[model samples]
Target: MILRSQRPLKLKAAFICDISLETFVSIIKTAYSYFTLLLYIAN
Candidate 1:
């Protein structure tokens, strides 16, 4: 019974990790693009 209850909690934690990772990737991409844009304007 305890094992079954803990299984769902593990799945929830994995799901949250996936979401945060995706968000982090998108933020990095946005920042990189902005950085390039700034360099282009400066040139």
Candidate 2:
């Protein structure tokens, strides 16, 4: 019974971790785009 409960918790943690990683990746992409645009405009 304890094992069953732990399985769901582990799955939930993995799902949350994946979501956080995706979000961080998106944020980095957006920042890179914005920085490139600024450099183009400056030149």
Clashes of each: 0, 0
**Lowest summed lDDT over 10 consecutive residues: which window, candidate 2?**
7-16
lDDT of each residue in 1-43, candidate 1, tens digit only: 9888665332234455533455666778999999999999999
TM-score of 1: 0.56
Q: Write the per-residue lDDT of candidate 2 for residues 1-43, one digit (tens) a residue.
A: 8888565322234455534455666778999999999999999
Error of 1 at 40 (Å): 0.3
- Output the lDDT of residue 6, model 2: 64
**Model 1 lDDT vs. the true structure?**
0.68
What are the lDDT figures for the candidates, one per model? 0.68, 0.68
